[model samples]
Target: MKEGAKLIHTSRIPVRWGDMDAYGHVNNTVYFRYFEQARCEWIEQMGFPVSPREAAGPVIINASCTFFVPVNYPATLVIRMHAGEPGRSSVMTWYELFVEGQDKLYAEGAAKIVWMDNATGRSVPLPEAIRALFDAAAG
Candidate 1:
């Protein structure tokens, strides 16, 4: 990941009551869910159809998140995602979550996904079409 990366998608996720922890703040794990949704939407928007039947698609191999601020109920989170330059069989996706309409960052995350053959459960090179999609999005 680099500084000033080009973001492919931004999504707003409403903070739900169930997302809060016993401490009255958003639980740490809930932030990853927001990142997941943003990543899925970005891939869809890039013209790649995602389904179990698809011969090849991205699968998360590594993922991590960092939280900086606590979010309470009655607020929305804006998650921004970026597609990194593709590797031979994997791509890195970066995420940043901010309080809606605020500059404060709530969380940051990154994921590395390997294109896999669903039937064989083996890693495979990203399809040319999908590679092009990521390239265009990164540009």
Candidate 2:
């Protein structure tokens, strides 16, 4: 997490057997899924629809992840999400993944999400309610 980033949401997701690859470790792709789940949970908790086809909704324009340690099965992942300053139409969300009861970080990542008009496929300003939540979190 960055210096000014605000903790927004935390999610506990169990590592599934299918999340592993032939290398016996959680696949790199699965890290993004974990990040997505946490972000979605945060959005849902904010009273926004996850995927609103007829209304403006959040959409990720960019995403990336960094693996610090290999994660194995039979562990519950604690993903904590943090929010940077909100822009007119987007916010940068950061994530940290760790095993439950463990202090070591397994992975970290971020995604830049922009509010978009579903019908027009163009960016729109962040909803006032959402922006207010970000403001409060930053405090």
Candidate 3:
């Protein structure tokens, strides 16, 4: 992670009671789903609506998360996402989850998404429109 990482999107998620474990903390596995929720919102904001009928879209090739502090139930999260500069066929996304109105981070993660052609089920170059949207947001 760099100090200059540009956050391109932000989303708010409520921690559900089901998200907690018997230990009274959010389960580690649930962080990935939170990241996915924020990532999908980012994709839609960038004008690429993800849907079953879409011909092309970004697919998560890899995802990982690192928990900082344990979060219990009865919390609201503000998830921030940064979209890295696009490569030929892929882009990296970074995320940070924080308690609403709090500065401390509860979790952070990154995901590598590659453009794919649903019709062919193969990787494809990022469309020019998508690249422009990212560029504009980065600015």
- Top-scoring candidate (TM-score): 2
Candidate 2, 11-46: lDDT as tens digits: 999999999999999999999999999999999898
Candidate 1 residues 27-99, lDDT tens each?
9888878888888887787676778888878789889998888999989889988777888898788898888
Q: Candidate 2: where is the Cα deviation over 4 Å? A: none
Candidate 1 stretches with Cα past 4 Å from truth are 137-139
Give model 2's TM-score versus the native structure. Answer: 0.96
**Relative to the unseen true structure, what is the Cα RMSD of model 1?**
1.8
Q: Name model 3 segments beyond 4 Å from true.
A: none
Cα lDDT tens digits, model 3, 1-139, are 5565678789999999999999999999999999999989878876888885898888989988889999888999999998777899998889999999899999999999999999999999998987887778777
Error of 2 at 118 (Å): 0.2
Question: Model 2, 81: alpha-carbon shift in Å?
Answer: 0.2
Q: What is the C-alpha RMSD of each candidate to the true structure, in Å?
A: 1.8, 0.9, 1.4
Candidate 1 lDDT at 137 equals 64
Give Cα-based local distance difference scores for all models. Answer: 0.84, 0.93, 0.89
